[model samples]
Target: MSVLSDLKTVAVHRDFRKLFAVRLVSQCGDGMFQAGLATLFFFNPQNLATAAAVAGAFAILLLPFTLVAPFAGPLLDRWRRRQVLLGGNAIRVVLTLVLAVIMVTQGVSVAVYVLALVTLGVNRFLLAALSAGLPRVVPREQLLMANTLTPTLGAVSAVAGAGLGFLIGAISPAGVLKDGLTLTVAAVLFGCASALALRLGKDQLGPDRAATGRGRSWAEVAQDLRATAVDMADGARYLVRRRTPGMGLGVMAIHRFLYGVNFIALILISRNLLNDPADAGAGLATFGLLAGLSFAGNGLAIVLTPLAHERVRPSQWIVVCLLIGAVSQGLLAITPAFAMIVASAVLLGLSVQGAKIAVDTIVQRDTHDAFRGRAFSLYDMLYNAAFAGAAALAAAVLPDEGWSALVFAVLALVYVLLAVGYRAGIARIDDTPREVPVPQPLDEPTDLV
Candidate 1:
């Protein structure tokens, strides 16, 4: 089906509509917050920076939450996911408010960094909860459409939010105050997300009582922690047993890693190479343009993914995405022109979003709810870790100008190798269709609070 048709069909599902609203609002807030941070760190005239510093910023923003993933998964499975969505967004609002204050008063410092870390950590948890909750609202057959729409639209919402934030920045008095003001706007949007989440009942999205444990004594707490560690490991084992989701995750991880490398490279090139370094506004404008173009590509993927999936299996689609990545990398390596880089951004966005939709469906379909939270937490971890690792790697190799032919060549080689390895290793499985049971909701709804 076309994107519009799929959306029209799903839009009538009441529960899904609410869940989609939460996703849309929350991601839009995320986009605004992220743009605020970008402006504060890289785009600010005063913050003339080094590659390592840039990498460190990425690390500070993403890695801490990744470290928490192993434990977070079990809680996601243990706690009511709706509660996580509600409470997480609430905390995020508070954090965003605090972050805004710090940006205004503390400027760039450890305090602001600390607050940002916690905020992002909570944001990651909220996202995992949403992914885990998805099967609760939609049928298994529509998993592809569900994944395609929720995340794709959520991404577009985020881009729109970023654009809105930028617009605010443009009109406001140009100074530290503007960045803080933009983040304050993000806080308000997060508050709206909290409100939207409240529309869902406590048990509406769940690891049902049978799947979750109740409170226990101190000794039980220790035992529970031990069990959580074991369960986290079991989650890994579970994925290994389900070769399809495992392979899908592997593809997702590789794509994210490459995406991260390109991300940092894009920042460097835009800030220092493509635009005049001394003209901070020009640099910011160039990077913003690339970001907007990439977002446009992401929007395009919403239509492209389902169509491609009709003709090819998801795993095969992944290979096609990796091939596109290789070609994009090759273009960047040779010319390094602004036009080529912009095209590369678009290609990367399309390929990444397309692969992600396929992978989300595979994982959601293959993994049961009992372990789905953990499965997605691992998914989040791999995605973020690859991204952080890429930034670290780029820091080591990329020049201030961010124009590195060697890095581009290496990235292209990795994509090609991953594509070949996937074809040999996983895609070698028989292409026979498997029966998919239509997933039911976790529980009948209780009264909305």
Candidate 2:
């Protein structure tokens, strides 16, 4: 069904509406909070002029929490999801306020970084809770529609929040005050989200006692952690046995690595090359415009991907995306003109989003239901780590101004190689019969939480 039809069908459910509100409001806050951070870290005249500095900032904020994410799943499964949503947003409200204060008083510092990490870490759990609790509120028949609508609308809300932050920044004088005010707005929204969470019953979003059993002892929790490690290893082995999905995952990592380098370059280019470094407001405005264009490219991909799929297999579609990425980077390699850069941003956005959609389809289609969760967990790890690794590589090679023809050329070549290699690898894999498990009843709600 069309997205609009799905929304109309699912909006009849009151609980779904409540949970949806929580998602929209909280994600909106997340967007504003991230916008504030971006200004402070990348666009500010006094902070992060060099690629290395930018790389350091990303590593400090992203890596530690990423490593800890898998462990959060087990805890999320144990906690009452309603409480998780309420408490998570409530905690974020407090942390964001404190972070705003630190940003205003001390500017960017180790303390600011640490607090940001904690705040973002809390956000991770909240997001997971939202996903896990989804099954509880929506009927099994409508789960797919609910899933589709929630994430898409949540993303739109986030973009709106970022736009609001930009508007606030544009009105306020550029500096710590602008960032602090943006964060303050984010904190208020977070509090609003927390209040909305109160509308759900304490156990409405549940790990139903029957499904989860009694609370685990410390030893049991440790054992579960150990078992999770083993399960992850098994999932890796399963992917290795299933060559198509494995290649898809590898291709995604390569794409993300290259895309991450491009992202870092764009930030530096927008901050220093496109605008005067001394004029922080101008740099922020330029970056914001480019970012909106990139998001516009993402919207275009939403339209283009299905059309491409009608003509080609998911695997072939990935090649098309990689080639598009190659051409975009190739343009940048030839020239760093503002117009070319703008076009490149739109194209790369299309390329990245298109590839990701194809990869997600391949993974889900090929992976067994039992291993799908682990497969996605692995995907998430690679997704974040690849970008972090790319930042480190960019720091080594990219200049302070972020204009490097050689880097762009290398990126273009890598994209081409990845496309060729991925296509060939998948082409050679023989079709093998796999076990097809019996389908479960849709009427029964899954105990995913």
Question: Which numbered prediction scores highest in lDDT against the true structure?
Answer: 1
**Candidate 2 residue-wise lDDT at 417:** 95
Please give, for residues 1-449, the per-residue lDDT of candidate 2 as tens digits: 45566677888989989999999999999999898888778876677578999888888877886687665554444456787788889999899999889878887788898999899878877776776677678787565446445755677688899989878877998565766999999999999999999999887876543124357899987887886676567667777777777778889988999999999998889888988888877888888888888877776666666667668777888999999999999999999899999999999988987787677666656765445545655666676788889889989999988889999999999999999988787677642324444223222222322
Runs with alpha carbons beyond 4 Å of true place in candidate 2: 1-20, 73-87, 125-153, 173-178, 194-221, 238-245, 364-373, 429-449
Q: Report the backbone clash tally of model 1.
A: 0
lDDT of each: 0.83, 0.78
Candidate 1 local lDDT, 106-163, one digit each (tens): 6778988888888888888888999999999988788788999998899888888988
For candidate 2, the 10 contiguous residues with the lowest summed lDDT are 438-447
Q: Candidate 2 — which pairs collide?
A: none
TM-score of each: 0.93, 0.82
